[model samples]
Target: MLRLLFVGDVYGKPGRRVLAAQLPLLRPDFDFIVVNGENAAGGYGLNRESFDLITGAGADAVTLGNHAWHHKDITALLNDPRLIRPLNLPPGTPGRGAHTFEVSGVRLTVVNLLGRVFMDAAHNPFLAMDELLAQPDLGTVFVDFHAEATSEKAALAWYLDGRVAAVIGTHTHVATADSRILPNGTAFQTDAGFTGPLHSIIGADPDGPIQKFVTERPHRFSVKDGPAELNGVKLELEGGQAVRIERYHYEEGGDGSAAS
Candidate 1:
């Protein structure tokens, strides 16, 4: 069996600090670790420094979401072979959507995909995935479906059932309770939540989202600091079938958000 650890969206500095503190304690149990780092830089886009912080905190590879290129510098850094963006992005986009790694003598392919429901335009993820699977199987496969809709994530999981080992969701920042193995043996989840401040609205200061909803006015939101939360899932894959899936959350000792 191969053990995989996938952490949800790492918001910003708080998320990075939590990972730095928690991963070392959790590292002994997993063979491979993947982290969604789209918002690791000030909760907007990831820069090279944030990328290094995530990888430095024990991430074997970092996956990105729609904000993959929020920082212009990321375009140059995407080709580093460890950072990945959405596979369904337009052709000629910088960086790869899928990455292959060797862990404990087993080859694993991790693919990042963006969902189109109420999201920015992207290629058909299902069709793109079909094309990817058309190639010879490289190794155990996993996907990070960074989407907003649960139905889309579920549909993709069912579409790839029995083909990949797992389809883990990200971008929602709120962990769902539907962690289960599908009929075809692929492990699935709607969202993996987030690793950042728990005292905010999905890692941002709640005031901004609240005001935007209440007053219908644009307001700048900043990543909250203090009392970081780490959310993720641990999976056991055997023969390309997920045998077990578990969700986990860790929080620093505190309750309130730190002053901005």
Candidate 2:
């Protein structure tokens, strides 16, 4: 069985710091790993250095969300063939957001899709998913539906239940408690939370976000440095379907101690 570990959104340098420190220690547990990095660059978009850090930390592939294009530097990262944008985006969108590969003789396919409701103007993720599920050779397929609305995210899980191996949601930094296998063998979760600062405000400085809401003003947000956490899920797939799945929440140890 192939163990796939998928991490949640990384916020900023502090997020990157926690990611770098935790991933290496968790590598031996999984065969392939993925990370959602829509906010790795200063709490907005990911950058070159941040990309390198995450990939260096052992992400087989990195997926983006609505904020993927927030940083201009991503123009180059998208060209690398490893960095992926949303597959549900308009046809001309750059970077391959979906790909198929092999691990220990097992075939695996990963697709990254962005939700449309309450999101930026993008292609229909449902239609895009139809095309992906059409492939017959895929043994185990995984989808990262980066979206904002819970209704939309939940619908997609049911939509692809019997067809795909798993459907995971991202973008909402809050982790959802509903992680379970669908009747059709697909593992589902609304959100995987985040792998960044746990003590701060939704992965950013608490003050700025609070001030903005309180004052009704635009505030340039920043990452808050403090204790950190690595959050994600582990899924075991067999015969192109998930047999077991579990969510994870690991906080950085205080006083120089590490979390298990």
Candidate 3:
């Protein structure tokens, strides 16, 4: 069996801090580590420094979401094979959205796809996935479906059942309660959730979102402070099939509070 740790969206300084502190204790238990860091930079987009923070904290590969290109310099980083953006992005999009890595004699391929429902315009994730899976034998395929709609995420999971090892959702910041193996052997979760301040609204200061909601206007958002938390999933795969998918949660300062 091979174990992989997939961390949900990292919000900002709080997320990175908790991750750096907790990963050292968690690393020994997993064979591979992947983190979603699209919002790592000031809770908007990933900058070079924030990217380094995530990788430095122990991410083998970093997956991104709709905020993938918020940082202008990230354009240059599109060439880095370890950084993956959404595959459904236009053909000319700077970064590639899928990558394969070999670990401990086992090959694992990770793909990122963005959902069109309630999201920015993008190609069809189902068709894009079909093209990727059509390639000869992509060993132990795992997908990070960065999407908003729960229905869309679940539909894709069922669409690719047995064809991939796991399909975990992101972008919603709130982790879903559903985590189980599909009828066809695929491990599925609606959303992996966010790994950052838990007191605020989805890692941002609650005031901004609340005010915006009341006024129906844009407001400058900022990363929230206070108690931080780390949310993620641990997958146990046997022979390129997911046999177990479990949620992993950790609180800042190690006082021990499960992710809510």
Candidate 4:
């Protein structure tokens, strides 16, 4: 059996802090860890510092989303083998969208893909995945579908059922209750939620989003700082098929004590 942990989008210093604090506690239980750190740098995009911090916190692979290139210096960091960007980006785009890691003698392929609905234009994820799976030697596959719409996420998961070990969604910053194994033995979740200030609006200060909503104008948003929470999913796979999947949630108190 292989146990895998997939962490949701980590939003800023708060997210980083909680991740750093909790991973050590959770590390021993899982064979591999994957984190979504696209918003790790000031809640905009990842930077080298954020990348190192996440990796140092026991993440075997770090995944990105639509904001994968928000940081001016991120282009260079994308070349790191442990970092994965959206695979459906235009050809010739820097960084790979998929990476393989070996743990306990088992090879796991992690793929990151962006959704096109209500998001920036990108190559068709379905076709991109088809091309990727056609390549030889892909072991027990797992996907982080960073998308805006739940339907899109679900569609892709169903489309790829039985072919991959699991499909977990990100970018929504809200955990959905629907987490279960598909009929074909693939684990699926609408969204894994996010790691950041629990009280804020999707990891950002509520003031900025509220102003934009009320005034109908662009407003700058910053990462919210306060008690934090970490959200993710735990999966157990046997023979490249998911046997179990459970949502994991942890909240931190002001004094930094964590509660599950």
- lDDT string, candidate 3, 159-221, tens digits: 999999999999998988999999989999999988888788999899999999999999988
Model 3, residue 190: distance off in Å is 0.3
Q: Residue by residue across 1-260, what tens digits does model 4's lDDT show? A: 99999999999999999999999899999999999998999997899999999999999999999899898878999878899999998889998999888878888899999999999998999999999999877789999999999889999999999989999999999999999999998999999999999989999999999999999999999888899999999999888889999999999987889765
User: Which candidate would rank higher by TM-score, 1 or 2?
Assistant: 1
Model 2 alpha-carbon miss at residue 120, Å: 1.0
User: Model 3 Cα displacement at 94 (Å)?
Assistant: 1.8
lDDT of each: 0.90, 0.87, 0.89, 0.93
- Candidate 4 off by > 4 Å: none
Candidate 2's residue-wise lDDT over 126-218, tens digit each?
Answer: 888898778687678889899999999999999999888899999988889999999999999999898788778888788889999999999
Candidate 1 RMSD to the real structure? 2.7
Best by TM-score: 4
Instruction: List ranges where model 3 is wrong by over 4 Å.
Output: 253-260
Q: How many backbone clashes does candidate 4 have?
A: 0
The TM-score between candidate 4 and the true structure equals: 0.98
TM-score for candidate 3:
0.96
Ranking by TM-score: 4, 1, 3, 2
Candidate 1, residue 144: lDDT: 96
